[model samples]
Target: MNKKTVKDFFDNLAKDWDSFEQPDSAVIEKILDYADIQIGCSVLDIACGTGILFPYYLKRNPLSITAVDLSEKMCAQAEKKCTDKRIKIICADILDTHTVTDKAERCLVFNAFPHLGNAKDAVQALCRHLVPGGILTVAHSESRESINNRHKEKAFSVSEPLPSASDLADIFSEYLEIIHVFEDESVYIVSGRM
Candidate 1:
């Protein structure tokens, strides 16, 4: 699917997106644990649809957060959910390094990696946003198989099947140091550091 298809599909689902799709809170906690983020963390939340991770990130006492999405409606919803002075929302394709500056100590792509048009380029771009030792994570609350099945739904015209954890780790290794790769019935995560 093209960029327009992705935007339109997510836009149509933006308004009650949470009720239709909710990530488990445990997974959010797991991501935080893996990253070992502390106060003064600067974050870049890629594909931050509806700001689902906003509250969690806020609780970390981050210095700042840059939330980005391709769907305008999704960004609008996220804007409504997060009113923190540190959080900034932008609606733009992740592939296009839009007007936002890229300087974050932690870049997290929660449940939004597969939709990227090119995994390799996406990893490379995400790496550019990080500080020298910053972490980048592509994580999902559900198993890879479960997520693939969900993307098979009628609304998904621009989604790609998720690569196995090892494949993802290799992709990330091209630009960053592979830290951890975990995939099981409960969650999938590929984390690396620049």
Candidate 2:
């Protein structure tokens, strides 16, 4: 999907996005556990809609967080919820060059991977900001089937079907060492080290 379409779709839904998509706490903990986010680590959150994962990332006590997204309204919503000096909300596309000036110890693409246009290209762009030995993770609180079915039912032009966890692992492997690839009825996650 094109950038404008994705941006507009998210922007239109920003106000009620949280109510529509509630994340499971246990699944979130599982994702964060697999993410291996250490205290004082720098983090990059891609497609950070309404900062859904911000509070969770904050709970890990990261030194800094750079949240990037394409929708202006979504970023605005995120900004309203974020008061921590450690967090910097940027309204921009992650696929763009120089979007994030600093490198991060952990880069998370949570609950938003399918909206990215090309899986390989998105992973390539995200890895550029990861410090050496840093990890990059793509995760979803919901199962692949559930997410895909929701998108299909919504008939959204901007949303693409999520790939299998193993396929995503292959994509991550092209740039970084594969760390984990797991999927089940509850969640989907793929992590790698740069």
Candidate 3:
């Protein structure tokens, strides 16, 4: 999809994002376990739709979090939900060379990876921002079939398909040390260290 198309679609939905989904505690646990998050770690929450991950991250007490999305309304809504001093919200395309760099120890692409114009190049760029041994994760609270079907159900801006497990394994292994891959009826998580 065109970058602006994706931005506008989400910006329009930002106000009602909570009506779309809430972070599932079980899925959040799986994500944290896969990433091996610890207290005081720096986190980059990419495409952090309406800051759904904010409360969970705060519970882990991260040192800092840079929540980013291409939608202005999305970021504004996130800023409103997240009152913590550690989180910084940015509305920018992650593919931009200089959008955010060398800042986070853990980079999370939650429920928003497939929309990328180019997933491989985008993954490489996100990996560039991590500290050595940092983690990069792409996750969803729903299964592969469910996510894809849901996107298809609506005339949404997400035009690209979420990669298969093997495809994602290749992408993750290409940019960072492959850690774990999980795909079940309700969730999917692919993570690695940078």
- Number of the top-ranking candidate, with TM-score as the measure: 2
lDDT of 3 by residue, 1-194 (tens): 78888888888888998886767897788787687766999999888878988888898999998888889999888888889998888888877896854478888888888777577887888887789989998888788887778778773566577877668989889778888888888878888887
Over 1-194, each residue of candidate 1 has an lDDT whose tens digit, in order, gives: 58888898889989989997777888789977776566899989999999999889888899999998999999999989888999999888767766466688988898888888678888887787889999999988889998888888753578888899999899998888998899999888899999
Clashing pairs in 3: none
lDDT over C-alpha atoms for residue 194 of model 2: 94
Q: Which ten residues in a row have the lowest lDDT in candidate 1?
A: 93-102
Write the residue-wise lDDT of candidate 2 on 1-194 in tens digits.
88998998889999999898888888898898999977999999889999988888889999999998899999999999898999998898888985755888999899899898788888898899899999999999879999899888873588778989999898888899999999999889999999
- List candidate 2 segments past 4 Å from native: none
Better of 1 and 3 by TM-score: 1
User: So what's the TM-score on candidate 1?
Assistant: 0.95
Better lDDT candidate (1, 3): 1
Error of 3 at 104 (Å): 1.1
Once model 3 is optimally superposed onto the true structure by TM-score, how far is the C-alpha of residue 107 displaced, in angstroms?
Answer: 0.6
lDDT order, best first, reads 2, 1, 3
Candidates' C-alpha lDDT: 0.86, 0.90, 0.83
Say which candidate scores most in lDDT.
2
* Span of ten consecutive residues with least summed lDDT in model 2: 152-161
